[model samples]
Target: MRPMLLATASVAVLTLVALSAPVRAADAPFNRISTFNVVENLPAGADPAKPTAAEIITYTEDGNTLIYSDSPGERIGFIDITDPAAPKAAGVVALDGEPTTTVVIGSKAYVGVNTSVSKDKPSGHLAVVDLATRKVEDKIDLGGQPDSIIKSPDGSYLAIAIENERDEEVNDGALPQLPAGNLTTFEVKDGRVVDASKKVIDLTGLAAIAPEDPEPEYVDINSRNEVVVTLQENNHIVVVDLPTGKILSHFSAGTVDLDKIDTKKDGVIDLSGSMKAVPREPDTVQWIDDNRFVIANEGDWKGGTRGFSIFDKTGKLLFESGTAPEHMAVRLGHYPEKRNKKGIEMEGAEVATFGDDRLIFVASERGSLVFVYRDKGPGAAPEFLQVLPGGVGPEGLMALPKRDLFVTAAETDNRKDGGIGSVVTVYQRQPGATAAYPTLLSVDGPDGLPIWWSALSGFAADAKDAGKLYAVTDSAYAQARILTIDATATPAKITAATVVTRDGEPAKGLDLEGIAVRPEGGFWVASEGNPEKKEKPTQNLLLRVGADGAIAEEIALPEAVAAQAGRFGFEGVAVVGTGADETVWIAVQREWKDDPKGFTKLLAYKPADKSWGVVRYPLDKAAKGWVGLSEVSPYKDGLIVIERDNQIGNDAVIKKLAYVSLKDVKPAPLGSEVTPPVLVKSEVKDLLPLLKATHGYVLDKVESFAIDAAGNAFIVTDNDGVDGTSGETQFMSLGKMN
Candidate 1:
């Protein structure tokens, strides 16, 4: 089992410990942060099989570890690491069948277990584990397979990801099995689990799935109590209501085509021939405010222009950053080479916000650096900022509020060094912050073989105080776990860390992808699904700890919906508010087949409303099935969904603008008017002349959408073109219906 390497980096030259770091203060630029590598491997008793599978790892508030099952390994690993730097082997646990993922609440941990890896028998079970005792406390046997899990913020209800299968025995005419995904809610009181309500969210009924493509990833929840999900095979994002489980709206975040860029443009580049936009990957989503979010685009296979899309609450298109726009500046050559100060530009910029200001900070993975820009303020033309060196393949970023610190995850290129990884650089802001420049205190990683093989996936911070930082990795072995460090701790030392597996057992799987922090403490982890399974589904796990730094509770998913035929999974998680009465929103990806009536589903859970049950909503229904649905965000009283549409025959397109309201979602008001079609007729000669004089296809792929409190929507298109030649992105007003 070659360990996968995850790396995250940043650049800063100064340090400020106070909450206020001089908003937009200008100062002289300083050198990038220094780098270091802290290597820690699993104990000798850990699995030695060298499994060729990926592992997902996460950390809890009390400092316990939560691990999910991944391919090549079909179990969950739980390790104790009250100490962030040194992790102790706790124990490994597995289900009677293949497990999807796990989530924790209070003192219980919920685990989704799939019984059959093959299509023959797709039944599964939801296993409940006691984190305090480190044992499988109970189990809920369910039909089909359970993909993912979600719990309300108040810990009242639990939602399970379920794929429904057709009643073949009753329909007996040799019809193909109609596989769909749905949500099942379980009530929680006094730490005990009880069944509540169940709703079948049928994706196949919404649209047809592309023949060769897989189902969408999972549905995500936003700040406004909305569910956002994607139609993977098709390129689209679906938005829904969390409280009522209703379908509100859907949109397309444009896709990208790497081949579209014409490096040798003898003439103007034509994107039509090269590539099409696809859906956003379910792995990346960041919350800007209660009503807005930014999504990351994977770009086309050929690697084209990729960036993020912004949207308002109510599923409307706002605006997107320019296509393949240069957001960072870098100095070439080695240090001391004064003449090498020239800068090079990078493509596909992803952004995150620090405060309530219009300036949004961006991280360019391809550029291997970070940049700052005015995302919404007046005359906001993104300006260049200091660049963090090394830390290639940056993905997700977390901002430390009071300490003025920022951390990012680095997904290392595995082909280079057998997939070993390292942490990216971390930087702190100084008091003398300015518009032209800013000071930073930096920390870098080691430069070697085994040290740079790991890749960082998700990030989170301590809610009460931003001084504690936590990050996870997407590695299989190499003790894939969560590392905890003090935000104000100088020299960037790993204070504590925890791995999923223990006792040298390979049954405990840990391929963690996304993570979020709760106000009370602890962390939530999402699994991307096992690569080995043809029907890849995702899962969620909750990890909680106490002030004593002990594993207080591990709440595994309770039983509700069973997995069936289609692929149902989860990606992102967010806690909308504070206090014990808060709500928890989870993202799920529901798959559809070639059937024209396929659709994607998103779900929400309110732990406080234990009896009210879990609510689900439909984002979009396609005549054709969608491929990958990645992320969701809450905006005002609604939600924004980011989806990647992978249609067959045509190039993939990304969907950006879409909305869903939480107030009142009644069966999508019947009798909605359909626009009349237009017809055009012209002579062949005239048509040829018009074609030669026109730009490529007017409609591009859209992947993700975000919304602000004022109802302004922002759409992002994945222009998968290189060298600014082929792909192009557009910014449009949502209300302008042409």
Candidate 2:
């Protein structure tokens, strides 16, 4: 007899095996397994230039098919999830209007289509799509714009949040901006809606503040035929008995006093700010049980408490995780610094019972992260299991307990913005599987708070400690800082941080891209320059800084070569020896005006004598975009460089580790007209496979490369500080490089 995975086996077969015995939840926790890009559904003749998104998602009765709302594409797309690890595109059902949410009942998908001509003239409908036919069979008028839709536990009713959302321009997003919103409901049987049973429930004058404008945001129901709705703009929660269409009880979602949070866009993650009495303008809510529920405080319109809360049936606060999620994000270097006003922006929540455990999943839109916790029950708080990187701006989540699967629908479409587009990421729970994300993180600082950091652009292993390493941030931060990482930790922790200072004040406007420890107790850093900025043209520099962060020296390109330097300057720096005999090598990202076509330079500098020399490095022919060098590091008898294409996502082609032996290599003088010999290169490894292993879009910047003290090679990608990118950083170690 074979004891096995049993993934595709029948339940009866599993029941027969379970009679022998089964393991506990301790074996398999939730972990991401795959990512599906929505662009694969771009229809025939459709402009590939346009964007598409996967907002709210739902699965079929058998959990083999996944349906998601695509607002930009004006359709509902499907995915074949028969094998959760390798999902395939199953086509799309075009809609007449923007899709807000999709819910599957039997073989039919009920999608809320927002047909609003304008905010003041709100209009929409519920389109019932026949999944097999791939067509919309019926449309039920919703009367107003709908945001979220939920079906009763017994499949007896469908509840919709008729959010006639207010225009923010009119009153700075204040409520009572009139044309108040409400709730709509209808009877459902066997997966088809009974149109005649529609009910428009009035939900006004329910909150103490802005009682006239009840902008319903999200809805969910209990097993007892009771529905809970969040009036986001008014900062209130209301429960209605679906059968009677009557408001049972209502109360304010309330405020919270927060501390140890970064409240400004200062480009640094210092947890010393505070928000007092900030209203919890919840966006998504889910019921854990008939008597308990959870709300994600998205802080739309006015308030965002920066966390999620659990409450009882009568609106009593059961648990408040104030600033806790944001703190956890800080610990993982996933905090979006520019979005400090609403740290992490908890926007989606899902609760499901898997095996003997009940799990609550909370998602952060701005942070692109999801926090998973195991519910301990009514009186106690949930236990944190792990944090998952859901694509960019994850707006909704679905938990399939029967299939042991959890899915996230990220609504961001950044193709037009030169970023990763919307994607539906798949995660599965299996015993003995390890959490795959956040390969590295930071520990608490002196204030007993997590060391907040992001936009890591460079990496170098500690010459002594096996798992200890150093990193630097890019221009995304105003103050140039160096962070120390302890990669030995399960999630690799950042033990400390130091701000790079020049003379006295923090180094300003530095686009630091590379760093190498100087063996003599300090470091040499490379700062990429931007010559086009209006303020002042910054020159690429090789800077030597003391162990305490004070600048010791700054070496610029020789005058003649500096005059012809383009925007793509030095990206990486590596030093080969000690003080007097040290030869510093700087890698130019791309060819400058003075260089040969399709070739970049490996410039050399001898600090012992202030001499400059340059050698050419062949560039790979990019299939679709420009290719350039990302990093330079001494490895064994030669130097290893990370060469990559500028394209992201599906357009990415080349991400390679190439090496150049230094045996007979000699750099030509910087301004010499004589052509220098280009180095003969050999492939060390193809980083493309490793980059795609994260189950995300192939990140464009494979910037940092280093071989640790234990001879293990490591690579880190730059997230562009979450600017236009998905804010997903990949830091992994490739064990033992020969």
Candidate 3:
């Protein structure tokens, strides 16, 4: 196979940095333990359709309970994590307004509530709630829309960032349209707030940009009662003494030159793109120690540099992550191509000391991942640890070092779009457990960039190699390509990629979903089609591809058979027999317009005669959504098929492997008026247990399955290219099928 040259010098440098990343062999790895859906705690009788989100999260002082602010529901939610692995719904405290951030002190929870009627009239308050009773005990007027709230390490002071946020629709989201946000602080006596000690410190004229409207976005407190705040829109950082409300130091958050990033939203991840002097408008800041802190350059208004940075109290740049984390996302198939302007959009940061190591976690909102790093003290580069799958759009990161657990609140609830709901995922630091994720990963190509791949819909095992497989990408990406996977690796690695080409150019309008190695040589790939699509309508096609990835032939269905096709078409393809008896099999997802009420067709194409035949396949009765076929592979004297329901998460039910015998059975010719013979099938394995093993919400797309020469079977799921899904691909081995 030839290496695709998609890397520039800058990209190669970034890739090299990732290739040589520090590895701490003795350190324990964090693995996901459980997942909790916020909807499970929804108030009784409340409309379930109303969108709810877990934006900011914090744990109790004892680290046995979790409190998260739900902005859409106008409430604060609590989860009892006494068992860590089995979190329960503790209840919720309803606030009259949107809850921005929450922090717990002793038995009480301090919540920043935004009651703003408009962007210009930013009004909010602090709601102190009794955690045991789940009741609001007190409310103190904050005088503006509050964003981030934190407490000093000694619990003597509380600092709130009064973000009089700007109205983006007014002037292209430019700054300087505010009531001028300030830092509001108060002295803490015992476990209560001293209302008389409320102090509003003016933060104006501190930043070089948008000095008049300084909207502080996030805040963190140090051991010395010093507060560090980030003015996200202004691209500035400020440090203040909590005891005297005096400005300690302040400086611009600054800009960086970025390379090897996908900057265009053009349905492709081209790492050769570059940008100069991109603003690092840091969003979340957390102090790693008294003199240093880390910032997530989320870049809300103008720039999102796609990485994080560490800075000292005097605003000195300690470390810049550059494009390393972004490149990691590409390697793991977590890159969000639609959000190219921000490129993974690093948005959340958390720092804590676990055992002997101070760990810094940086989260990517678009990538649905969290990059872990071991802090190496002040002004030093932190050692990169393994990254974690933080669900979809992870917004809140909280580390409980004492409990050896980490939590992330994913804000995206894509249930309406047939995706999963908002979830709070828990992970534990196991001493010697290998990372359970990235079950499949892509290695760097000869060009130095990772062989970026995702949306795996079908698989074909190598005829000679037991641990080798070939996978196909669906329509999630523009250019269709075939990836080679070495299934023997701990986490199956994609060793190479071959782009399916036509006339020396990457093929277009092809949603390649199935692949099968031809008995003679080359491959036979099935491209799923949708006739209802108004733009560039496609037809289901079976292509004969050469060993070099070039198209040798394009075979379409007969006109009579093609006319009956609907949105769903060929989902999987396989080959059986050799030479004169060679035949290609295709699994049609869902039912065509002419299919019977509870059955779809299994297509048989004879390569020798170029004739088509079909046998009806029975679909399981779905209790909720529609049932469909995902994959079909030839096994023994029969074929194994993956049948599943369209429901995701807790609602999923029918994800299974079934065997259908084909001995002595004949398929009717295409467009036959008589009823086709129904193949008898027996259940092979229930896939629910394997799908739930990773401890994440059950994914809906269980699309690929294949059995190798050694009879080893494997199953893989398509992430929809991280579109609405969590970008988590579960590539697991089902051991031997025979």
Candidate 4:
């Protein structure tokens, strides 16, 4: 087989800086240990659909317990992390209003509670909860709703950002609304708040965007009791001395010029776009040291730069990261092309000193990843360490150096949306550690940029090479293409792509789901049919394409079988034999209208005879959703079939591999008087454990599975093209499957 050149003349090739990153391997790096779902902390008879979130998480003083805000549930949930590998629910403390942030001072947890009646009249309080009793001890009435709360390094003072946020729908989310936001500071004595010492520092006339309505989004206190806050919408940053209650300094967070960014949302990731003078509407701000700080330019109504910036204490620009981090996300296939308006959507940041390293973590809310970098002090560019998957919508991040741990609160609770609920993910650090994620990646194309690919629906291993494989993308994109992957590289890489063309042009309106390489040359592709709609309903098609990717033949289902078609048609294809005697097998995704309960079909066709035959395949019963087959690969004894349920996360019951032998097999011709025979299948491996090992909930699609030339089996999950999903792709190899 000839190697396909993935590089194109359109985009510049990008380097994998992460491959040779200057990582501090002397100590073990942080790797996810466990995931704790907030739903487990719900009380008995609680309405599960009432949407709860685990946002703004913080560790207790002892570092053994975690407290996270649950705004929708109107409570703060606790988790015992004494054993970092097995986190336990420590129960939740109910609150009168929505909790936005929490910080542990001694044995009491100070929480920012928002009790606003409406956008016009924002109201909230500072709720002090006793950790031992799991009850609110006191509630200090704050004049407005609170967004961010933090304590001094010495625990002598507490500062909060009274956002009094503007409603987005109100005049298209423009600023300068009434009931302006301000900075509030209070004195703390013996872990108790002094009510009389509470001072409200009016932070108006600071930013050029909306000087009157200064919406303070986040606040962080440095070692000298100095507070640094970010006004995201107004694109401003301010520094205030907590002891004197005096404004120390202020400046606009400013704009950034971004290049090599994918700006178009045209169903493809083309990193040739650029944005000039894009506002760095920062979200979260943190101090790397008393002399410098970092900002996550998440953007709001105005702008988003798709990167991070570092600035000196006096507002001097130190270092700028244009599109480097977000580009690395693209290398890992986490690029959200549909969300190109803001790029990766940088949302949060956290800084902490661990051992000999002062690490800074920048969170991408849309990409579901946290890019870790080592701060090289002031004036020098920080070195990129590695990127970690931050679950789904990792809104809040915290690093616990005292316990050598890192945690993130993923705020997206998709239970109501047929997805997994919110989760608090834990990661542990040990010396000389190796990274685990990004099991698969794409290498730089000829133009230096990584080859862009997503929605990997089907896989086929190279017949001659042990680590070489071919993958097909679904109709997520406009064109149908085949990707060649070299699994020999660390974190297997997609080296090239071939567009499946018809009459020398890219195929249109085709949802190709499966591919099987021909022993002679080229491939046999399968397109899953959708016959539910009346007009332009797709038909399950089997196409034969040559080595050049030009369509040689297109076969459709028989009239009798096509008449009883359902939404799910062909999902996977595998070929046995060669030339004229070559027999092609197709796996139907779900039970068709003609199939019986818990039974789908393994369809067979002969290229020479042009005859169609079918054999029944039994499915495992699902507890909540339907079960179906995803892929079919011929193994030594029989065919290895990927069987899974439509459910996701913990609701999933059947994601396994079932084998069926062809020793006594004879598929009856479809529409014939003879009875169709059922293949006897036995379970070989249960895949639930492998999916759970990633410290994320079980994904719904275990779509592609194949045995390589060395008899090594591999599995990959589809990310739905990162649309309304976390964009976390799992490509795992289970060693050899004999």
Maximum-TM-score candidate: 3
The segments of candidate 2 whose C-alpha lies over 4 angstroms from its true place after superposition are 1-27
lDDT of each: 0.39, 0.85, 0.89, 0.85
Question: Which of the numbered candidates is closest to the native, going by highest lDDT?
Answer: 3
Expressed as tens digits, the lDDT of each residue in 1-738 for candidate 1 is 111111111101110111112223323222223221111222345454344122323334343342434323455654443432333445556557666556676677777777755443567777887776767878786566675455554566565556433333544512234344444446677866664444444444432333122233334355565555444333344555656767666544444323222232222121222334433332233334555544444432223234444444344434343332221121111111111111111222334344543334555554444554445432222333444333444443434333344444443323222222323233445445432221111121231101111233444445554445454444323334565544343222335545544343321344444455656666555544433364543334433433322334433343332232144455444456566555555555554231123344443444454311223434444434454455455545555444444341122233333445555532221122321121111111111112111122222233323332334333323222212111122222232111
lDDT of 3: 0.89
Tens digits of lDDT, candidate 3, 56-93: 89998888889998999999998999998899998888
Q: How many steric clashes between backbone atoms does each model show? A: 180, 8, 0, 13
TM-score of each model, paired residue for residue:
0.40, 0.95, 0.97, 0.95
Q: Which ten contiguous residues of candidate 1 have the minimum total lDDT?
A: 7-16
Q: Select the stronger candidate by lDDT from 3 and 4.
A: 3
Clashing pairs in 2: 27-431, 27-432, 28-430, 28-431, 299-303, 299-304, 441-492, 442-494
Model 2 residue 185 CA deviation in Å: 1.0
- When summed lDDT is taken over every stretch of 10 residues in candidate 4, the lowest stretch is 1-10
Which segments of model 4 are wrong by more than 4 Å? Answer: 1-27, 534-536
Q: Each model's RMSD to truth, in Å?
A: 32.3, 7.8, 4.5, 5.6
- Tens-digit lDDT track of model 2 for 354-416: 898888999999889888878878766666677778678998799999888999999998888
Worst 10 residues of 3 by lDDT: 1-10
Residue 380 Cα positional deviation in candidate 4, in Å, after optimal superposition: 1.8
RMSD (CA, Å), candidate 4 to true, equals 5.6
